[model samples]
Target: SRGRGFGRGRDRFFSSDYYPYPHRPGYPWAPTLSREDEVRMLKSEADALKRSQKEIERRLGELEKEE
Candidate 1:
């Protein structure tokens, strides 16, 4: 029981060379966020979706005109 201890083992497990898969989560630990940050993030995503939707509609209309 007197080896280098748990932290050393855990560190070796997470070291860069040990990554075996492409889909590893970007962060090593769970993130922390408050209600305000969560709301802001959701609003931004909604705005992006709406803008992309309108752009897609415009592109579809243009394609229809070409035919």
Candidate 2:
């Protein structure tokens, strides 16, 4: 243990997820999620999906070039 954080015992982060519900166990259907939170979450998910799709497309293109 020394300088700043991330010393000896601070080797890893918590196993528990900060984003609750759907992503984590026992969260269940949260009908109380605010409209703003829902919108933000949806936007983030969409962005993630778009990125994944792009990555898949790029890999497919590379594979096609190989063949």
Candidate 3:
């Protein structure tokens, strides 16, 4: 029968367009930044986090006062 052919079930595993692995040829690696650039990025992230934390604390205090 057609379903019993040797090539019938092979396309799912060995198809040309199938990507069974994570190694992509067109994908790029992360860029390497200088020490100063890395420090700047971290500092900006820390500042943002600190601002968010302060906002969250203010909201929590308001909720506690209402309770």
Candidate 4:
């Protein structure tokens, strides 16, 4: 019967063509970077954040003055 076929498929767990790869037991791959590169990226991000904060504060001050 069709019900028997469906039950067998469910038991085997092999119905679809899509299958996932088995995970390897180990630490994930992470890239290593030099200290100079890390510091440059951090400083650039800090400068951008500082600029955005200053702009936000200026807008808030303008809104306060208008109130």
Candidate 5:
């Protein structure tokens, strides 16, 4: 029967902002940045992550040597 679990309909799907569909008409559906800008941003983030990982590894090495 049409209770709390059955036949709730499609209204629930579009209620959240995280839904895949656009919330309103004429909204920009794609990234505004150019391909080069996106690539540069990603590369910078990756480099920062790599540097942090290297620092962690170095600290671990020092701790192991002390033990």
Candidate 6:
């Protein structure tokens, strides 16, 4: 049937748009760690990055002032 074919084609197109990673053995679909661990790790990394960025900006300002 023409209508059935079009419906299948539309479903296929929409399904293709939502591409998911291929499932593999021993792979988790989501984070396995507790929320606290995740938040702590993220915050630690973010704070370190922020400190590094501030240091870079301070050095740049010093260079500009010297020029």
Off by over 4 Å in 6: 1-31
Full-model lDDT, candidate 5? 0.73
What lDDT score goes with residue 16 in model 1?
A: 38
What overall lDDT goes with each candidate model?
Answer: 0.78, 0.73, 0.78, 0.75, 0.73, 0.74
Query: Candidate 5: where are CA atoms >4 Å away?
Result: 1-31
Q: Comparing 2 and 5 by TM-score, which wins?
A: 2
Give the Cα RMSD of candidate 5.
7.6
TM agreement with the true structure for every prediction: 0.58, 0.55, 0.59, 0.55, 0.52, 0.50
Question: Which prediction has more favorable lDDT, 3 or 5?
Answer: 3
Clashes of 5: 0
Ranking by TM-score: 3, 1, 2, 4, 5, 6
* Clashing residue pairs found in predicted model 5: none
Model 3: residues >4 Å from true position, as ranges?
1-27
Error of 1 at 66 (Å): 0.9
- Per-residue CA lDDT of model 6 for 18-66, tens digit only, reads 3455742464588587999999999999999999999999999999999
Q: How many clashes (backbone N, Cα, C below 3 Å) per candidate? A: 0, 0, 0, 0, 0, 0
| Tens digit per residue, CA lDDT, model 4, 1-67 | 3433365553244443334456435688989879999999999999999999999999999999999
Worst 10 residues of 1 by lDDT: 9-18
RMSD to true structure for each model, in Å? 12.1, 9.6, 9.2, 10.1, 7.6, 10.2
Which one wins on TM-score?
Answer: 3
lDDT of 2 by residue, 1-67 (tens): 3333355443245332354446555646757779999999999999999999999999999999999
